[model samples]
Target: MDTRDLARIDLNLLLSLQVLLEEGSVSRAADRLNITQPAMSKTLLRLRDVFADPLFTRSGRGIQPTPRANELRGELQELLGGIDRLVKGEAFSPADYDGEITLALSEYIGVALLPPLIQRLHDLAPRLSIRTITRIENQLEQLAQGNLDFAIQIAQTTYPPAYRWQTLGSSPPAILVREGHPLTEGEVSWDRLASYPLIRLYISDLDHLEIARSSEAFIRARSPQQGSLETSHLLTALEVLRSTDYFLPGPAYLVRNEQATRGIAALPVPEGASYELQYRLVAHERTAHSALHNWLWEQILDTLRGLRVRTIHRG
Candidate 1:
């Protein structure tokens, strides 16, 4: 059929056409439906003329829907719901969401931050479906393309103008050592730390030059060692440290959990030798106001506040 024909037809006819395509045979369709066989046949003919495609045809004992009919099924289902919502003025509530949401986050944040928030969301909105994609490269592009609703990352000193950011929390990096490591025994001096092997956690394109520069300055002033064994993940670094006398420097939250610290201890770095890492929630400003986006943003902030309170009380 021509585009002009579709424009002249009533849209409600499309729903009847869709139902006829599903049932295939006119008699079975009429039986399953409340309509008569002749009425169903009339609707099928109308659909054939409207789309200018034989949407279905007779086979041996039963009829079969053609490729076009098969393809229209999914689109029709969504369109029908959209039409219903528009006609009735449907509203969305966080507590009653039955839609799916996608989140992009780094491995560290996904492991240390999202669990409790997701659990709480599950309790509140059991029908909501959430999918998490990790270690997303080019996070801003993903957000702009609607592939990701939100992201969590270490806030950098500079960012593109398209992104809106909110600080979640910040904490200083800490040195982690095995329970019986020599450094944890007594007064661990800077020179004494350098005497043992060091395991470092490597983030994507993260500037380890700063660490190298600081180590050189320390060696120049206090004669400390300046060598490291690098690993890609924090958990692997912790594992290496546990087996050998190696030391690892990473965010405290990752190791603060019971599994990582069962036989590990966080050591105090020498005065003036630490860096602060700040966590930030980022999204495309244009899409940040969507209900799902805002809900995720609030969930993150709430989880961070609870974590802060727990940390303070524990201390």
Candidate 2:
């Protein structure tokens, strides 16, 4: 039925039905709802007519809901709860939100960020479930279509204004190699790096990702297909970096976690090869006035704000 059909429904009747279901006695239901028993009986008749089911049947001593009422019991409570929220508007506490949000980000960032992010959110909004996916066909488009709630991506130069974003931090280049690799022993340069293979960051859905390194400086290739080994899992990438001579190119802080990278090391980008990236928290403009969306965005921004990505100056 159209929403316009809802105008015919007296919302009070649903409340009465709920009370009746809970009380199981007409007199008790009426007393609980502050109405006369006859009035309550009449309301129950109206509800019956509306639902086309004798919502309750006489049991041995009292009353019991029919199969239809039994079904509507759960659905009706949900419907009434929605109505309550709608009437109350956006004044809500995070602890009250029982919704889920899907976030997209490269696993490289997720490794360093997700633990704290999830912990903070769970502390503040225990009822909120955050689901993360590492690969997506397109980040912004997914936010626009409501398929994704938020994304932590390498910043781009400009957005169409239909999207909202926050610059989380810088993501300067970090070349990851196993502890015993030759690059770790000698001066690490792009020329010396050429001897061993590079492990490219693989987010298979994106053909290329353009990263806005900084306000004035720009880098040509952010998502260049540069490596022989392409894997999206951070742990897997770290394992490969531990076992092989191949190097992984990524945000510096990703490999800086000592516990996670016991046998891996971060090399500053060579002077001539330096490029930078900034992490941006992106959401669609559709969520502009959504208190919940904004609240979650703020939580995310707070969770990932202080990454001090180091940079090397080039002549």
Candidate 3:
């Protein structure tokens, strides 16, 4: 049979045919379908004309399905099953979604930012699982190959042609220090900041160079013993600063969250010494519009907007 001819077939007839084949009697089939016996008999007549087969033959008490009907039964059931799945959406429940969705995020962003969103996802979809990989490594390739669903990163000057991005929010970088740090007592001048050992939370390779370029005057004034300590991970840098005199420069919004303990305080980075970091949600252009993918995209934006509004209200 021509495949296109199959496309013209009425799907409701196929369902009725399946019911008749299973029941082996028009009255029984009508009972199963909640239709009148005469209506089911008319449907069976139509099915016979469409397939040019006497699908069932009268026996003593019940009808017996013809060989052709028996042969088509399994195939019809399979086709209907596929259609049901397609219409109902994926079998992923929020609580039992076992399929893995990989995301690319910096250690700092993941630690300081993603906790609440993760909790919300768990509450909404108990089974949906998430795996976060480092954002700075092979991000475009990972996204292109379908290994990653989305990425959260500080916006940069350029991105690969294959990917697209949406800005979440932007915030001025602030100095994070211990509560009783000497700089917090009064105005923190370049010389005063230079005296303390700086702990750098470096997310990308370019951050180090950018900080040096922006803070050249302070770097020149600091003594050799007051050099900076570098860590590839943001959370580690924050933990280090919490214990010792080391200072960290990071986004003020991230530090304002519940993660920041009473022991730490955010201070303004003095004039000409501040940097702007933009939070961005990124994904491959190809899959950006998919239902689940777009849902996640909006969630990130909503969360960022709520946080920004709350900050404004507090100030």
The candidate maximizing lDDT is 2
lDDT of 2 by residue, 1-315 (tens): 698878879999999998888899998998998889899989989999999999998887678999999999998899989989888786868988999999999887887788888889889999999889887877778889999988888766567879978888775777788887888777776566666766667653333445423211212322243446667788887888888888777777665677888888888766655666767888999988888998888877766553333222210
lDDT, candidate 3, 250-303, per-residue tens? 677656665654477888877787677777788998786566777677766776
lDDT of 1 by residue, 1-315 (tens): 599855877775677866666666678777776889888788778878877888887898667888988888899888888988888755657788788888766565666677788888888778888887755566767888988777776665666898988988876767688888888878766777767767655443233223444434333443234466765555666677778887776667666677756677888766667666777787888775466667767877898889778877987
- Decoy 2 TM-score against native: 0.66
Candidate order (lDDT):
2, 3, 1
Shift of residue 129 alpha carbon in model 2, Å? 0.9
In order, the Cα lDDT scores of the candidates are 0.72, 0.77, 0.75
Task: Select the stronger candidate by lDDT from 2 and 3.
Answer: 2
Candidate 2 global CA lDDT score: 0.77
- In candidate 2, residue 281 scores what lDDT? 87
Instruction: Give candidate 2 misplaced runs (Cα > 4 Å).
Output: 1-90, 204-208, 211-227, 306-315
RMSD of each: 10.6, 9.2, 7.2
